[model samples]
Target: MTYSSGSLINQKKWILLFHFIIGAIIGVLLLHPLTTMVFWYEYKGLIEFPGNSPIEFLIQRLITEFKFELMPMSFVFALLGGIVGLLFGLYHIRLSGQKNLVRSLEHELAEELPLLIARGESEHLEFKSTYRWDVRQQRTNRALESIVIKTIAGFLNREGGTLLIGVEDNGNIIGIDSDFQTLKHKNRDGFERALMDTVKTSLGGNACALLHCRFHDIENKTICRVIVESAVEPVYYHEDSVARLMVRTGNSTRELDAREAHAYLSSRTTKSFSL
Candidate 1:
């Protein structure tokens, strides 16, 4: 799970060594012959038109003058070796990154963040530019709180997902600056508290237990990543006089009536109990 610094260093060394050896072999087989030919024909001018055919001339030239430019030719080969090593090293790094992406989703989210933001919207992930920042009105969007709560409740009633606030649907981080302006503390803490208050008020105090909110400053923008865990009990976005049950279907959130919700919950519990 954890790689020591010494092991990582050794891994790098092995990759470099392997690439260097391969490059040296290729340089010897490919570049060496071609370079020797060029030197013999152009610089030396030892092979006259009738003195010898091209093949015989080349073979004899290589046999005789192979040592003349040995140091310079070796330098060229070393340069080629370094280039090959660098290319392969870069490829190895890329493959390592891809493996990490496939192996640990948590690592991807935490470390490979550019790829994480670029992962886009799915059943397990959603993005919102802001909680209450209304671009048109130039103020906080009042309906934003309910919308977020509904999304959270939807996750709770379904397989659960991460809700990234301050990230647009198109995966752009506009930041929570507008929302922060409305808060008293005018920072991440205040914004988080306000969000939790909204969650507790809109859904229930108990729903807060199912959600964990964390703030990240990325690309000079404050992003709120809320991880909503699937609840044992189906969650409902309980507004005044209306407890609307919501669920996640693909990338969109859908609401269910009280009767429909009861039947869905009943069927789910029955299936779970049987399993």
Candidate 2:
């Protein structure tokens, strides 16, 4: 639902009003005894003693100086009234604020998802640092590789996902360490080729057709992107044309589950039947 600007303004006003009322009530209650103490001490010659006897003396002084006859039931009722009113007001304000927060988040997500899906944001799609494909840390840090594979695979296995090689999950454009020349020097056709080959070997053709590898440049630095379309068949990576499987989950590539294998086959069979 949409909240008009006027409604939002009124909501803020109500919030402030509630806070003001609670503060006023608390201020009066806390200050009333102090005001009464001064009146009793100054006007009625009532005094409180020092140290351990201070509280006792104050109670005595208050009883003697304050003569307004109030019933225990009335005082109890009044105190309860103030406390309940204050609590209810505070709760309402907090509830309103939470509602606003949730609404704002929903609105933000609606805007962000479109951009993310379109790869519309330059900061998200383009490269930032010089390392396009360094490969210096470890030849095959299978752990890190797993995360990339998982994200890509999850994206592909669901609807589709664009894996930007050089960026973090938060859309910070950190370029991969290796570029085209770097890949060629390292005897790899491209990052996509290596990733695809790996996925194919691991998943055994389940991940192949849906995979698209490409590069984009921002500030003369190249960043790789692997786009995985929804799987019509199970894609697996093979080593030396022998089936050895890997499927990405988050940043880790693991052997496929029976469920995943079945899902791939089911999707392929359904598509073939439709065709």
Candidate 3:
């Protein structure tokens, strides 16, 4: 999403400058009278009502010579400077927020990658060795595809999460080699296409849009990363007469049967959040 003025990257210096100047203008307009009143209250009572003493004469002379009250530069500069500071401060906050988000993803990818896999599953993550084809054993297991789809559908139904294909539940990055072997292209691209096709057939085109897939080569194995965004509406895996609806709960994917599914869907609690 683009901001009010420019692209997030590339020659964006002008955008910052623009924001600062605009902020300064707004600050001046908003705070000028308020600041002036504050200074007037603070100084008028002090300077105008100097005590009748030796120091009073000196104070009177100082006021006459400096005319500090009449000098509007102080208020103008303070107002403008404060606005510019706030402008940069807000921008820095935004930039830092984005940086932290990226850092979080990087951390998630690296931290306990093996340990987490060994620990088994969680609400946000799941691991699988193959999609439908077994690379090492060389076999087609259609049930495996159902498991993958059901998990993905559940994830979409809930918080939306990561599904690592080619990694066993034991945290092994076995990769999608089996699926790759069966592919005519024998590549990550072919594997991703097949995965997408499966998703399309089971979850529909709109649901497919919520999914993003990438291939990562770690330790000479190609692990497929499937980042599923939470579906705005309900997502179901439909094939033949049966449809599987589930949600990721704790370390397991819980299939929702009719009575439970109806109560859950009827509650409509998931609407408050975005993917």
Q: Least lDDT summed over 10 consecutive residues: which range in candidate 3? A: 57-66
In terms of lDDT, model 3 sits at 0.74
Write candidate 2's Cα lDDT for 204-227 as tens digits.
Answer: 465677777655554454456565
Give per-residue CA lDDT, model 1, range 130-208, as digits (tens). Answer: 8888876898777987788788888988888999998988888898888999888898889889888988888888888
Off by over 4 Å in 3: 1-119, 135-137, 269-275
**Candidate with best TM-score:** 1
Clashing pairs in model 1, backbone N/Cα/C closer than 3 A: 132-141
Estimate every model's Cα lDDT from 0 to 1.
0.79, 0.54, 0.74
**CA error at residue 155 for candidate 2, angstroms:** 2.6
Q: Cα deviation in Å at residue 184, candidate 2?
A: 5.2
TM-score of 3: 0.57
Report the poorest 10 consecutive residues by lDDT, candidate 1: 44-53
Off by over 4 Å in 1: 1-108
Ranking by lDDT: 1, 3, 2
